[model samples]
Target: MTLDPLPLAQALIRCRSVTPADDGALAVLEAALAPLGFACHRLRFGAVENLFAIRGQGAPHLMFAGHTDVVPAGDAGWSVDPFGGEVRDGRLMGRGATDMKGGVAAWVAAVATVLDRRPGLPGMLSLLITGDEEGPAVDGTVKVLGWLAAQDLVPDCCVVGEPTSKVALGDTIKVGRRGSLNAAITVHGTQGHSAYPQRADNPVHRLVRALAALTAEPLDQGTAFFEPSTLQVTSVDVGNPATNVIPPSATARLNIRFNDRHTEASLTALLRDVLAREAPRHTLEVSCSGESFLTRPGPFVAALERAVQAECGLAPKLDTGGGTSDARFIARHCPVAELGAVGATMHQVDESTPVAELRALARLYARVIEEVQG
Candidate 1:
């Protein structure tokens, strides 16, 4: 029997596996893949759950990676249960229908189709499913990758099933992702009556000057495959309600989305230099999530282009303009690209995917598998 992605997609949607929670999502996957002769291994890192399943062996291994976790369904105004997995008005409705439990279901069904046809295809097929992609990401793909490397199970090429399409299923494939960094700076000053001009130094003034230095100019102009780096001040707080007194300190938070022209170290150094000059007495805390990366266009990318054109009749545009995904983690080990369903409803209320689009994505992934392992 040919595997249909619809039922599996619905089954996955029914699991309330919101970030850091398995909620039996991995069990569902294990049941599906074990029937197809996959060797499934459940890896638990801290409170996070991960799965690694492989079928077949030898050279030219192709791995499909995704996360089962979904962001929380916020305040409820949904027309259906967020975990109901209801099929209504031609859409599969749920929390992860698009980003990206639906994508995972499609790839699994595609693998089933390939196996049924060849049964013993000349190469290997594997999956790296994580439960922490929507969380801190410290315990997910990063840790599994180390295990894969130690076991010598790295693939020749990998495809991360993140929702990459903007307007249509095959319209865009993410070739790279910008790096993300967050910084919090606190400026110290003396607290005193506001009327005393020289008796108190206003930390808020210092904080504003420091931020001005950081945002004074663009990080850089656009690169060949990336847009210019951007920094946004998210918050500034003094928390003082007294109008007559100057606050002792001020804090500001900033987030940066950067491209290949910069690294975390380079950006941090720049930030320190600015703070030192503009706000002489301050403490800064920095957090770097994923560094910028790219997979240069090559045979693997060409094959995906051909597959997408043949399946969807559209030339997929290679892009590097999105928030980071597990592709960043995979990029460190192998050439990886991200292509999946339209992301119109990824993290919003009534997060959903059209039934027709879900099935079409299944066909698209099947074509990718064929082209890569042919």
Candidate 2:
């Protein structure tokens, strides 16, 4: 019997599993996979619910990675209850329809389809589902991966079911992601009256000059599979009440999305150099979310493209333009790629996906499983 993703997708969407809240979402997946003979292991790390399910062991292993956690549905404007999981006008309407409970359902259904036909299974199939992808992400895939590594459960290649398609279901595949870096800089100055010409150090001028040097030149023209690095100042604050007073200090926050051409350490050094040269009296703090990663067009990627071409009739374009995802963590374990449903409604009110498109995505995943272990 061919498996359909609609029912499972609806079931997951109804769980109200907003990040750090299991709300029975993993239970829903556990119920579905257990009946199909998968040995489901519920792994909870730091209050986050995660599941690692597998049917077979050893070589040619294929893993499907995703998260059930949906971003919170804000007040109003939703035609249907965000957690109702309603099927309205041939669409599966709910909070995670596209950002990814829908994709998770599709992969499960695809596995069921393949197993129902070939009960013995092909190679091995595993799933890494987490509940914290949309949140701080410290306890999700990154931690689960450590456990998988300890247990020697790493697959030869992993596919993250993040909604990678931009226009249609199979038109795009994310083969890589840019690195992300955040920096906070505080420049100190002496507060003094505006009338005194040389009384104040004027931190605002120093901060502006520092920022100017940081954004002076493009990080890079562009990379082969990634866009040019970008640095944007997100916030600047002085908080001085009096107009004549030169603030004691001014702080600015910046975020950088960089291609493979740069690493977090290299970028941090660059920022420091700018501050030292332009604003010597400053303190800098930096945080790196994830480094850039790319699963170059190899045999595994060719197989995925072939599956997309066969199942969806479109040659997938390999892209790396999106923000960070769990794939960044999975990339540290093995070569990973991302392909899933259209992300048009991800993280928005009344988020939904067409039932027809979801079923097509299930078929696409089935083809991917076949190609991976064929």
Candidate 3:
């Protein structure tokens, strides 16, 4: 019996599983997977719920990784309830309808379809679902992958079902992601009256010069499969109310989206060097979300391409452009790629996915599993 992804998706959406909150979303999935002979294991890490379920135990293992969490549904106006999981005009509407609950349901339905056809197929299939992807992301796939590795349950390759498509179902597949680095720089100086320009050091001037040097040139002209790296100054503040008093310090926050051309360490070093040259007395602090990574074209990627063409009738463009996802962590374990539904309305008011597209995505995932496991 083939499972309809709509009902499952609706059930998932009904659970207000906002970031770091399970709200029984994982339980809903576990219920569906359990009846399919999957051995489910619930793993909780620091207030986050996660599940790792396996249907088989052998080589040529394939893992499906995703999250059940959705970003907060802001108080923005909506035609339907954000958590109601309403289906109107052949589309399922909810907070996570497209960003991922739809993809999760599609994968479950696809697995059900595959196993119903070949109940005794060789090799293993598993799911690594987390409830922390939309939150801090600290206690999710990264932690579960570690547990799986300790148990010798690492898969050969993993597919993250993030909303990777651009315009159509198979139009694009994310093969990599740009790294994110955030920095806070404070320029120190002696404070004094505004009239005494020569006596008092102006930190704001030093800060402006430092930022000018940082933004004077492009980080890089981008790289193959990725766009040019970008740096944006998020804020510059002296926090002084008195206009006549020169502030003692100036602080600025900056963020950089870098391609594979630079590592977080290298970029930090570059910034530090620039600070030294521009503002010798400035203090700096840096934090990295994740380093950029790419899975260069190979047989695994070829399998994805073939699956996309055969199932969706579209040759997917192998892309490496997007914000960081769980794929960044999975990339360290194996060659990872991301593919799923069109993300046109993810995290927006009236988030939705067409029922027809849901079924097509199921077929696409089924084909991908077959091609990768064959």
Candidate 4:
């Protein structure tokens, strides 16, 4: 029998699997997969829970990657309980209804749907699921990938069940994602009386000048498969409450969502060079989420496009204009792409997906499974 995705989505949603907290979410999914002949591996790294399950072995190994973790529900004005998994007026409502959980359920149902029609799977099928995608990501997919490397179990390709669709299911598939770099710039200066203009070397003024120089130019015009790089200042801090005192130190945090034109090293050098000219005395600290990567339009991408056209009757647009995802990590190991439900409500209040849309997504994923193997 083909598994209905609705009930499965609800069951997963009801677990309250917020970031870094399993809350039986992995158990619920592992229990479901074990009955279908999957050898489940529950790997815990630090405080994060991850699951990797495989049903077959050898060539043409295909992996479905996702996370069961959902972001916090935020405030208290929901029409329904954030974790209730209630369906009202033909919509399934919950914290993870669209951001994920729903997509995860749909993919599992797709596996069942495909298994029902054929005597056996055409190739090895596996799932790399983590409960840390929505958190620090320190011990999530990054860790499981290390384990997979140790066992030499890397797949041929992967499809991440992130909510990539924009207006409808299967309307868009991300072929690549921009690189992300976070930089913290702190400028130290001399504090003095505000009345004496020459007595103070104000750090805030120096910080603003450095930031102005940084934002003065476009990172690039953009690339064919990617968009122009963007730098956004997330926070600026002086922490001084007095209006008459010149602050001695100022700090600012900014993020750059850059295309393949730059890597973490190159971008750091660019920032440091600019700061040297604009604020020579500033100290800089930087971290990287992941470097930009693209899976060129080849067999892997063609498979997903064909699947979307077959199920949704429209040619899906191949895009790369989104924030970072776990696909960045997978790209190092195998070709990867993303497709899932419409993401209009992801990470917002009263997040939800229509009942019919959820079912249709399962059908789409089932087709993707078949199209990729051939």
Better of 1 and 4 by lDDT: 1
Task: Give the clash count for model 3.
Answer: 0
Q: Which ranges of candidate 3 are over 4 A from the true structure?
A: none
Model 1, 77-171: lDDT tens per residue? 89899998999999999999998899999999998887778786878999999999999999999999999999999999999999899998899
Question: Using alpha carbons, what is the TM-score of model 2?
Answer: 0.98
Q: Model 2, poorest ten-residue lDDT window?
A: 115-124
Please report how far candidate 2 places residue 227 from its true position, in Å.
Answer: 0.8
Clashing pairs in 3: none
What TM-score does each of the candidates earn? 0.96, 0.98, 0.98, 0.95
**Reference-based lDDT, residue 124, model 3:** 93
lDDT tens readout by residue for model 3, 39-91? 99999999999999998868789899999999999997889999999999999
Candidate 4 per-residue C-alpha lDDT over 1-374 given as tens digits, one digit per residue, 9 for 90 to 100: 57999988999899888998999999989878887778999999999999999987667888999999999998887899999999999999999999899999999999888888864667788999999999888899999999999988999999999999999889999989999999999999889888985988998988999889889899999999988999999999999998899988999999999998999999999999988887888899999999999999998899999999999999999999878899999999999999999999999999999999999999999998898765
Which runs of model 1 end up more than 4 angstroms from their true locations? none
Worst 10 contiguous positions by lDDT, candidate 4: 114-123
Candidate 4 has a TM-score of: 0.95
